[model samples]
Target: MTPSDDDRTHGGLETVTGAGCDGRDACCRLAAGVDRRRFVQGLAAGAGLLAWRAPRATVAGPFAADDAIDHFVPADKKLAADWVAGLFARGERTWYAGDDLATIGMPVGGVAAGQVYLTGDGRLVYWDVFNSNHNTGYGAVNYQAGRKPTDVVSEGTFTAATAVDQGAAIQVTVHGRTVARTLDGRGFARVRFCGEYPVGRVEYADDALPVAVALEAYSPFIPLCAADSSLPATVLKYTLKNGGDAAAQVTIGAWLQNAVLNDAGPELAGQAERRNRVVQEDRFTAVVGSARPLETAQEKRREPIVIADFEGDGYGQWRVEGEAFGDGPVEGTLEHQQAVSGYQGRRLVNSFQGGDDPQGKLVSPEFVIERPWIGFLIGGGGFADKTCVNLVIDGKPVRTATGKNAELLEVRNWDVAELAGKRARIEIVDAQSGPWGHVNVDQIELRDDPKTDAAIPLRRRRDFGTMAVAVLGGDASAAASIPDGDALEELFAALRGEPVASAEKPLGENLRGAVGRTIELQPGAEATVTFVVAWHMPHNYRENRWVGNYYGKRLASAVDVAAYVAKNFDRLDAETYAWLETYYDS
Candidate 1:
């Protein structure tokens, strides 16, 4: 039963040869070339039911065919899931919010109306504008570079002007902010600029040279609707006109402090293992946040059931890539106190570090996805710790877990009920270069049920929606916040290992902080800095958290957010496209 080429490739859902068969036909096709008894035995074996004496159907939940919400549940869930999965696969973090701000329709999720901070140079220094259903904190706030990288603009001057709606976009104006005499008694060079919101961009110019400098700073994470929730990726783009005769050498850098801000204070900023570690990847510079505990009040004890403690695997339960028997330039080794210290116990550890060239993977055999949670305990650090553990179901990456804690093992888990009743695979990938690049794994667990405890975090609840936006910044040795322009300059230099001539003080004396990066642009060359923030929703917002009168208000707010997205979807789509058309080609 071979399928036609068109039938197999036409629709996005590629069905197996007999997948489209009717119920009776499916049974008949499945039974073909085999006896009924053998087929039944095979099904039993596949479902891990060979030990059971009798067959039984798994009962999941209640259902009402006539109820409107119940009727729409399956369709809505599938639509949302498919949409999210599709966007994630394409490396897109926002919905159909066109490419640019010229987009005609109202944008849905990206940046909302709230308090926005503008740098003296008109750059969007910080913004706390998104709408959050939760009551505690405001939506999301990110400072440019998490701190200032004044070295990027030290040679020139830029001042903030005015913010206005320029018919097609929201433009924040900036002009020359500094005036000083050099040895020859001439004013410092100045540039005119306009920073566009909703577009996540800034455009500036310096036109006195044979090769002029035309800079356009932008981030593609700008959306017409609410952010993607799971991965709120924002990339600030800078295009420099290095087309001039003389090549200009510039340093691009950022100081990052990626901390989860709830209502918690200094603790969140204190426990950072790698405070603004400069991460240089092949394509982009990024700062990863790790060891960020969900609970600031009291540490939650994690006692996950161990699935693979590497105690003994004589049967080869794991698949090793890049080499055989865990030995090579790129391989996973069964280590017993080799590079690091003691293994979790006498059990051998699955240590992975494929040299700087080849990427290594340690994959597990198939397992049932009926469990409510899946996670692993991992610890590693050094020149590179980009190793990531993935949850793959039916050949798709449903969730990912990573570790930046070079010192201690941390518990990382992800919900997997979406793939319940299915078979899934666990894959650990280490496809990066640099020192301390290896990852150590001990207990790999698939939790059977949620933990029962008093004062559970809102995130642990099966129904409450949870999302996070991580802002990456430069290398800050400690938690620091800056306000004045002069201090911002010293902070960048300090991050770059240069000595500060004057006052070296904490940017802010509180718990708030950020991490960042820097980009050096030749006269005509351009660079874009981006980050992705993510969210998870189970349609349990009103079901889990809100119960009484509070639930009513929350439900109303949810409706408003949903309505806003729906109403502006079409308009934002057009507006985004229009804005993209101008910048897309450039």
Candidate 2:
């Protein structure tokens, strides 16, 4: 059947085009276990939910009658096979919450929340925040770069201030903290301030012409990749071959599953084309092609797999963009041997947006959400020396493994948001320097632990969570009481780089020693690194407290050192790891 004009989109689950339901009530029409009475109650007003969209259900899961899957068709296997498949299909709207959304209603789920509906063409999805697919965040975050560009304020003064959309507040950041700075008039506003955070600019509508204050964050157009303080200057390589007789060239770029669920955009009602603001912040494209024909059959069968061109057909179809510094411009050769290289830029601006151009705001890693289980995959692929995957639960650090060393970033079958808490930290320690990217997984099959339904609980916040790293060239500590291994040692060197205060007598000395021996921090012109917590929304005090207990063990020292650190740290009243953001701790 053809997709209707009002069908919701995403997975095969769209709205109910079969009479009675008028495409408008997309939520209440889902085939899932939606309560009919409450469905009507929830559809009281016309909520413009078209503008935003985001995550979950990459592939399909098991089809239990209770699952209430609607309008989903698996070409090769069930939806569960595709890690990023849709849970609720057409008329199967109700789904669980994404990492960003917080828990919606009190005491949700339990077959009584309200009926949710899915759109018709494997598109549009809706669900009760508290219902079966629970947990939710305030709203999806997106690049709001329209009138102006992504900005990062620096530490200097500007001759004048540029006018953005009237009364619109601009996002500003300092160190790692974020805030808002609004324009008073429609034209140039005066200025004499300094600090870095709100970079990016458009032509200032003024006489003095906003030369974009100093450290006042210049780079007029920081790409989205340049905004998130986490992007590292590492190149990823993939290998895709011709699996079919048809000869073809592939255009590749880092794509994101834009999570901002703003029902405000005009494209809200499932459209063949997405016209809303995806903001293409840091969009670079590469083309991969092949001369030899790829025959279809069992040998080359990779399901929903995205590979780089081989023959140099696997590596050829991949696209290459960016000046990429040292290598000048890598058109199509991804040498797994010479992979993990250090950043060659200024390396001091804590975040990506704090730079000159090619800002991080636009350079998001290429992300794809598969069904069955969502794995956070980043960078190129390697078997022995590749990317690192870190896991943080509650406020504690979890262990990472690969059985044998590999050059690929992976987290097998993660069921949770792959430990994407509001406060989880992941670091890449590049010692062996082959390829050291990282990935985040949301679902995982039990490889060792048979505990089928392993749930990472959500509570409040606290000294919050501890930080940890999954080094590409090393291993983690066997036990907190013992020192880290050699693998972790080199890893720390890459992480610590040079001393913070000074190499001669670095400020966080003892702490650095403990961590450095754990993983090395490389020095010189490299990517300026900063610690990051993945958590976004907040739980209640109790929930937050549970999260803190889960990850903070790494923060504690051993024996004598522990005592000294403890005494001094106690002076801060245990608020070490911060749980900032209005969504949480409020």
Candidate 3:
């Protein structure tokens, strides 16, 4: 059987021989049945090599014919042609400049770990490692706009804006003059990029700058070793050569954004409490960034009055209909369902007994709404009224809510203050079928506390993760600040060799910011500045599944990852370069 076009493009098998036939016999039969020249043409076309045509020649091997041109090609010419084509493809991996730059973006993260693209112009872009599907244009905006805590379920729109600019850039100062153009290929006379799989290199040349700058970016990638290869970090090495005759003093500064928790919904984008601070641990210095919860006044609360804990062996009083709710409350996640969380005790109301095909409803006994709030843990389908929990008062639903299409239950509170002292019954409905067609509910309570409550500590409402930028050598001075108008200008000034004081506090909250490092160098000498961007995002969710991350288990935080990488940078870089050397030699 011939493989499909998609299979060919993705390196799938080319052909499968019929049963009971040896490969050589099938090949011989195929060669005998078709004209030699036509077969070659067909083979080329099938291999997606239509641009290159085979030379005119008779079939050359035991099946050679004398009907065509006298030219005789080798029997293994096809294999040789494939090898030559591969070499040509590899040779095409040289520097890409100008128009070719647009095509130079490649993923540089570990397998199954999140990744950021290294663009041709030497900037890191398209950060998708956050475990959430972010919008293509604005990396800060999540595609699922209503997935965040406190967000109302709604469709999201794409904005014509770029991702949260990390300001991941480098600037050089020669003598006392600051170069206007950064190393990201803007305004440079000669800017070229070359991507060799895991490694990407960009070269910048300009007459205005006294030194030529080259930047190599990559994450740790070791063949046959998934553990070492999958570290959540990107290593950037900058090499500067002073080619000027006179002694020229140079200052090199690098900057990066505190992009932790940047993947927020559009409504909450401006409310993220991003924080950045500089930390010195052991011999390494790093700028650590994280997202803190927004500050709000704590409300006075009273103990919740338990309405239904769902801890009993069966539904004692609730009336259950259809096969979806089964005979009683489920012990946990149902068969074939993702892990269920945020539920109290061992059992919860799960309407997925026979998968999503079954539809049913669980009606609670009538109870008095004595408190100002009715809190419950809910998850699953976001079908609104079709698949939701409703507070039925006077035979009508006074309050209703559906899950946000998640398996992880979240605490939701209905403000029943106006309906206080009224009689109501809870109805958990699952009328929809197919994907996310079921519903999960647990720990319904009547409480004066308007906020949602849970038996176990639920996932934090605010995104809390850390990303750090560490300078390899201890000689460089580092600083981190919120990227306000004046702060950015100060950073640029520092990059231009201006004397600036490092932030005394070195800590900022509730703001977007950048971290920078500065270094000084003298002419007639070559120096290399290396920066490591490490992230520790332990929490990752797909739909409602909490997948977590591989690197999160190994390192406690981004600082730890940065420190580990810094301590082993020599070995890692050496092994990577050795592999590159072997590849080129082969």
Question: Which model scores highest in lDDT?
Answer: 3
lDDT per residue as tens, model 3, 430-489 = 998988889999989987654433332223422347777777777555666544554335
Better of 2 and 3 by TM-score: 3
The candidate 2 region of ten consecutive residues with least summed lDDT is: 271-280
lDDT, residue 270, candidate 3: 22
Q: Report the Cα lDDT for candidate 3.
A: 0.64
Tell me each candidate's TM-score.
0.29, 0.16, 0.57
Please tell me which model should have the higher lDDT, number 2 or number 3: 3
- Model 2 stretches with alpha carbons more than 4 Å out: 1-191, 194-453, 458-586
Q: Please give the lDDT score at residue 462 for candidate 1.
A: 30
- Candidate 3 wrong stretches, greater than 4 Å: 1-93, 133-162, 264-272, 299-463, 486-488, 493-524, 542-545
- Which portions of model 1 miss their true places by more than 4 Å? 1-305, 313-315, 324-343, 348-359, 381-386, 405-407, 448-586
Candidate 2 structure, TM-score to reference: 0.16
Candidate 1 lDDT for residue 539: 26
lDDT score, residue 536, model 1? 25
